[model samples]
Target: MSSSKAGSSLLDGSGGIQPISEPKAGPRYIYYRIYTKQGALESNNPIYSNDRFISRIVSRSVAPPHTAACLKKHIFRIEKFELSTKCTLYSSLSDQAPVEDSARLALRGISGPGVSEIDPVVLVVDVSDAKKRSKVTSVEAKDLVEWSPTRRYVYYRVYDEAGEISSKTAFDDTDSCLGRVGTLCISPPYTALSLKYCIMGAEGVSPDRVCNLFEDEGGENTMKDGDTVALLSDNYPGVSKEEPLAIVYALQKDPVNPSEQSNFTKKLIVTVYGTWGDYDHTWHTTKAGEIFHTDGILLKKPYVTDSEFACYAAINSSGKKAFIHQVYSSFG
Candidate 1:
């Protein structure tokens, strides 16, 4: 993979892609390539052997930042190769990005049907980088972006429940706020751990499966610090690769079914890991049957007028069953 392809000056020995030499070792970069064997775009990234892994195939200017993306994954692969050279990169829209985000949000205390979440790392905005000529756009909960706080950047889900994209403030608290909100971390290749509402989530509405969104809008706060965010369904993340994290979701009791019964209610819990911010985080259910966490506690939480009282549940750090199942208990 490294040797120049014979007879081809531009390519290496096997006629594979080649990296232009850096006489001075420019800024540093990581390259990803796409070798199409067939079909439309792929569902997974490609694999490259140690001998075939082209670590040297990249430009120095934007190398380091780009390589950082593959940090969690060992291989960025042949398809990712283009990512190395391409200045602009979009996330895998289908499943990879959603599952990752769903996992992040699920662990953060946000779960239930139709909840499309995202990693907070991608929400980051570094005002310090204003000089880098980077334009800031409110990242979608659906976009494939990551965050690095050490680099003074963060990925935030800034949109409102009404489907309004978040606007930014020049205030310095942006950094500290993200940090206090658990949206920022100090790890070396540090990244944000935030979640967003997944717009393209499961559509199966089971009668026995209780979901509290529009009816439970802006209510319920059961998340605490040090807990996980689960991206799952009661069947917790069905078709989410059927992975363990894919099977995590908040367990709703009481109104487990039969919406006609006024005594039925909804709650939130973590069935997955690293989907939301943390257990200490508070949450509210929207009219859309989606759950969200917030640092700003609501004065008088929303409620269902029906006789059915709802409660949210989650496995605490100590594995205790915690929930705000009763409206009266919640107020107290």
Candidate 2:
């Protein structure tokens, strides 16, 4: 796996959380370590299992880079002939392709009732590795019932014996690496396709609108790159009045450089939208973040804007996603 050389902070979002003191001495202790440019590349990466190397992992197609990359589905496909023994393939920790990594995987084993016959083990450096003078701690396989290694600025789920994800680790301020928003692109309008609205009181009555970005120079959607664009209302002419007002939406993408064409790593953004008005605000749509190909960049979250505005998803020239929003002049 390639190490990230770009400068970034270690999950600076949560200012209230204090820095982890050190690796506590115990059977099971959670340790936090930061990997700067110098320490990013560990001697052992792409940890293998049963002497077989972990290759390509199934990743969701995402657009532009620096958006939140969802490590959703990782299927380890190994030909029957590749396996020297009967074993399930586990994914390597980082988002990097195993074909690119030549490092040897440090193998460990845990034998118990539910453990796979050829289960894979993770390799983590002692906290002291980050702080040379600090005391080195050991995390044994028995003590660690589950270990999800955070790498490539994306956190993944811990897999159980059945190859099912036991639990998902959300992005936070305490991880080995940190992610940042990448470049922004705004050009060549794309289509919005459709919009579906669901209200609390109304069950079987959802509304759909045919909306397009029409994103030319000096367009109605006055949004810039990285700004949170909320689709506030169904202001379209033929829209029904029964639909609720003050709806908000935010679309987020994964981390990938748009300028780099060879990077097949597709970018997919989750469109999370809710109502933002008064104190009665509530979430209307949960899983609305779907990316369509129209050629553009993807929109990411944390809605860092100088003022409030509404946003919509569009596309660029390369069939990637983009974002455009309508600014509320009063906020400026």
Which candidate number maximizes TM-score? Answer: 1
**lDDT for each residue of candidate 1 in 1-332, tens digit (9 for 90 to 100):** 33434546456655566788745423322332211111012113212221121122223232223333442122233222222221212221112222232132111113321122222222111211212332232433344333332222222222223332322321344332111011112111111112211210112222122222210112333222222333221221111211211111245344322233233233333232221221112322112222322122223322222233344442232223223333322220
Stretches of candidate 1 above 4 Å error?
1-27, 31-43, 46-255, 261-332
Clashes (backbone N, CA, C under 3 Å), per candidate, total: 76, 22
**Which stretches of model 2 miss by more than 4 angstroms?**
1-100, 108-332
TM-score of each: 0.20, 0.15
The residue-level lDDT of candidate 1 at 5 comes to 40
Lowest summed lDDT across 10 adjacent residues in model 2 is found at 182-191
